[model samples]
Target: MSSEKQMKVEAVTAPVDLGEGPHWSVKEEALYYVDIFNQNVHRYHPISGNHSRMHIEGGPVTLVVPHAKVSKTFIVTVGRDLAVVTWPDPSKDCVITSYKVLSSVDAQCPDNRFNDGKCDRKGRLWAGTMGATDVPDNPNPHLGSLFIMHNDAKVTKVVDKVSISNGLAWNVKNDTFYFVDTCEYKVESFDCEFLRGVLSNRKTVYDYKTSGLHPSFPDGMTVDTNGDLWVACFGEGKVHCIEPSSGKVKKDVDLPTNSITSVCWGGPQLDHLYVTTTKKGLSKEQLLAQPLAGAVFRVTGTGSRGYPATECNVSLPK
Candidate 1:
């Protein structure tokens, strides 16, 4: 574990309204993420310090995953719809050349929208939705559900009655699935069956309420090569590395601002940790005090490495 003094944390992009998902694409040798409120997808190349964004004009773009078999195409969740997007050039800011909606969920709840998501090693996408957060920092509870998008483009509901479906990760062995429902304030694990795309043996791995880390919400997360979980603490402004087996906090990496949204591993060796944050809901005083609230940050010298992000293998509609 790298101490706060030894860890290197640097802002990598200009502040956005809300920065959420941070994914490192090994193939492109770049980092990809989304600005939900701004309705855009951004790509940042660490080597050249070049950053570009594509305006997603449908709705709030929650997450973006590269397609396993298609180049320049991706699987993204725009509002309640699971969609496909094509980005012809990533070196410059541009509009998506093509867009297609595969399916939409929460038809009965007009305010429900997709939140956090990621692909399994098998290239299956697992994403969840959250009820409207009309009230600042308070999302409607129990209206969300988790779903899996298979390779055939089939969508199936896996878990129901969720509140603020947030961070998600799968273990190195691909047999355990870890998740977070922000409202619950706990990290839960599930026994995974990749072939059938099902989860069982649900158990709480870490409880924030009891861990003395209150007033903070567990948001985005990722697993390191050692199978430990790195969870972003939204209000706490830190990332806690937890050992899944013992559910113990192995280490903590503090950020300069609150409202930390997500984290991912980048760099050629997958040893750099990339973090995202949001400026939404901040007051004039809070904004003044936290100028870097919405900027993307990169932390290195954590003494750990992460696995390459798995691309979505879902076949697009012909």
Candidate 2:
């Protein structure tokens, strides 16, 4: 099957330092995402050009989604724990959850917050980890693993040895899951059983190129209406649209900044593509030059919206 030829970008916010997870709230018609170093999650409206921020009383926030424990609830991943926030109103009345750490291994270091995550069809939270040290000299994927949390708050290590867990997307119809071992610059797919929360038969669905106009590493991603995988390149300055089955580059949307972190499909028809980026880890000289590097941007062309993330089941022992 042949796809489109061009990609476009619309600027939303400036200097999105490590813009990671982008999720579309259809009912609210708002786009939600986090700027990792900024310690904030931003809500943006495309047509009205209005946006708002929720400044957490903690370190950087990496990902946001409809809350796992409650309906109409939202999950905000603070550094070490997942907080539940109630967005009863778009403009006001938000209560943040003081949740317990659901991961089996506790986070004991500073700066090591949850990186990227998504809820599977059965509403199970699948989150990835990064190192706690924020220093540049210590660039290692320390203790990073992919985890699954059930409704009871029981956490299981689905996979380990991940450098940076940045991307999670699945094809429900095919029972196929696409997971990203981000620091390695590739996307791998596995067969999944929703009821059992198990994965098997893994293979490389899409491997990003190191030498090209394509982005540096795939950060956050979502599947399209046509099963196309849309990935945000953390240092590459663009989103790589790929055919997951064939591992072919269909198109790449260029952005003004170099750190494109997360992406989602939105718009009244779910055709609008929203991207979050970062300015984190850049040298002082680089920051001055790319002052607005860590901002958010939008793009539209495929006329596809993202699927809503289901409520994750955290199976806790009573």
On lDDT, the candidate that comes out on top is 1
lDDT of 2: 0.70
Summed over model 2, clashes come to 33
lDDT of 1 at 267: 94
lDDT of all predictions, in order shown? 0.89, 0.70
lDDT of 1: 0.89
When summed lDDT is taken over every stretch of 10 residues in candidate 1, the lowest stretch is 132-141
lDDT of 2 at 100: 40
lDDT of each residue in 1-318, candidate 1, tens digit only = 444567788898999999998889999899999999788999999888899998888789999999989898888999999999888888888876447998899998889999999998889889999998822246468888999998888999999988788899988777889999888888999998878988899999999989887768789999999999999988889998999999998888989998899999989999999999999999999999999999999999899889999999998888
- What TM-score quantifies how close candidate 2 is to the native fold? 0.84
lDDT of 2 by residue, 153-268 (tens): 66777777766777888884848888877656678888987677788888887766644534467778888878888888667676778888778877777777777677887778
Per-model TM-score on C-alpha atoms: 0.96, 0.84
